[model samples]
Target: MVKPATAADGRWDADPLLGLVAGCYVAAAVAPPVVFAGDAGLSLAAGGLYGLLLGTVLAVTAVVWVAVARARSLVVRLGRSRARWLLAVAPVGYALGGFALLGQTGIAGVLAFFAGLGAALLGIALAAMAHTRYVAATVDEASVEWDGRTGWPERARRRWRRGAWVVIGVTAVGFAVGVLTDRWWLRVAAQALFAGGVGFAQTGQERRYVCTEAGVEQRLPVARRLFGWATFDGYTRTDEAFVLHRPWRTDLRFAVADIDDPEVLADVLRRHLD
Candidate 1:
């Protein structure tokens, strides 16, 4: 979690002006590819390469800037402020403008624009989610009862394996159809199905869980999720695991063996649920 900056610590307070500057930098980095493509008569691939180079340079520059003690404070403040949302809009507008400019070039340019836009949007979403998890982990007065890594329970593993098998079967059928019908799109669909099946098979192969005062945090390989106390009605304890009951979502099961002290963990849950 990002700690608040302090004058006493010789750190400057967050400045909204710094945030505006950062937003401008981001816009400049992301918004020039389409213009470059049109003016230089560049191909779709060249436009994408140019965008990648600009984004990489900007990321490196931002990293160096944040490494400075005073600038780091400003970055933390910007992340926590409402102004950050407004800053995000500038990039979206520029990206849309770039897309419009690319449309005049050709269909290939339009497709390249959308592909880059999709990747940029996804990266932003993941960064936001990670920041939220970091903040949630540092909730005030939150005590951590148990923290460890574990895999899915036998029941859940069996269910996932069954689902994976079904998906794999479908993928096989799709591949056969693609070969018989000589359809490139069908082949692409088959490849996607195969990837999904593989992902399903690997789901929950490893996970880290933290039971804290404010909530339970589950960290997967690429994602972090928090299940707050208010979201769950209660929990049920079995010999091997604790199952948290949510009103509208699937229950979360934590293995008892993964906890250092099951009784202490139970006490923490009781204090919240009871």
Candidate 2:
């Protein structure tokens, strides 16, 4: 679960001013394509009415994007197959309504838009739901012994060192792409990748994780988190991931390679939860 933060401190992932501008930018980007691609019968000659309609469309887009961006989960988990199907129905409903209203230029274009839109909205809604349902059981956060300041586990240290170099190489490729394509966005993405690589490298060199009897304390450039057995509803270990299940939401994921000692960690978790 995400730790709650107040707006007073500069702890937000996104800057408010920039986020607002980004929302508006997204609104503008999305509306024109839809309106221009629509039927010939749709008129924009009435200046006042057209402006009002366009504004409304922009407003809706901004709201949806901002809401989804601020939403809790990046993906959704409905817990069961049948429930998932039920979630899909809402998007289908959106498509139907869109078809009824915007299908003037034949069913094809309308169907494409509505279908894509419905799917996107459904995914966003599910993620939001997962975020909402996510919870961490109560535990003694204070008095938690943390040896993280010493160093990362030896295995994790090696992995982090390797991963950082790989990421930096990727960032270089991204930089090259941006230069070749003359795309600012590409450069921005490259910058983000570089920053992440730096963070990873620093994590390896800095104080490591806090491993305790209760759970593991994960430290990042952004925040410190403790995931304890007291909250473990279930767990699934796979080749790629170590998933810890708590209540309500889907499983929490950690890279399998990132763990200190997988066998020992698994045993401790099993013992405590049992």
On TM-score, the leading prediction is 1
lDDT (Cα, tens digit) per residue for candidate 2, span 123-203: 444433332233222123563443424344456568767989899999989999999999976896798689778867765
lDDT of 1 at 45: 67
Query: Against the correct fold, how does model 1 do in TM-score?
Result: 0.59
Q: List candidate 2 segments past 4 Å from native.
A: 9-53, 61-89, 100-260
Residue 30 shift from truth in candidate 2, angstroms: 13
Model 2 CA lDDT for position 262: 66
Among the numbered candidates, top lDDT falls to 1
Give candidate 2's TM-score: 0.34
lDDT score for candidate 1 against the true structure: 0.61
